[model samples]
Target: MTNATRISATLPPDLAAFLDEYQETHHLSSRSAALAEAVRALRDQNLQEAYQELGEAQRSGQETYPDDNLDGLENE
Candidate 1:
């Protein structure tokens, strides 16, 4: 059984063709898998940028988000 949910999307002509070619060239099982990989890559990039911003804020002594009891929660 698969854990994927299906949805319909309308892509531009050029992007749709590119996705099809990429799927074929990389031997992915389906276009859905290709799209999932692309989204995961984008998410990783955004998360890295966010971590960098947080680190800079800490270094510059700027008040960012609340530093609640997060370390305590990790042991629970």
Candidate 2:
């Protein structure tokens, strides 16, 4: 299992209500779990964007990749 970290933040009333509903409907244990999942999702999105930018740079000849096969791996 992955290790976890604790964090705290303030949420607007509407957002808090939505989170509460989401937890109850999904049978999630706590607000921390929901927030952790949200953070992971956001981090993944950022990493994907960086990967896409690198791909674009390589395609435009602004950056060079070490191996041609690595280009195919990006799509997979």
Off by over 4 Å in 1: 63-76
The local lDDT score (0 to 100) that residue 62 gets in candidate 1 is 90
Model 2, 1-76: lDDT tens per residue? 2666656789999999988887888888888777767876787787778789888998898855445434323632
What pairs collide in candidate 2?
none
Name the lDDT of candidate 1.
0.79
On TM-score, the leading prediction is 1
TM-score of each: 0.74, 0.71
lDDT of model number 2? 0.74
Clashes of each: 0, 0
Residue lDDT tens for model 1, 1-76: 1576788888999999998998999999998988887877787787678779888998999978565723222522
Q: Worst ten-residue run, lDDT, model 1? A: 67-76
What local distance difference test score does each model get?
Answer: 0.79, 0.74
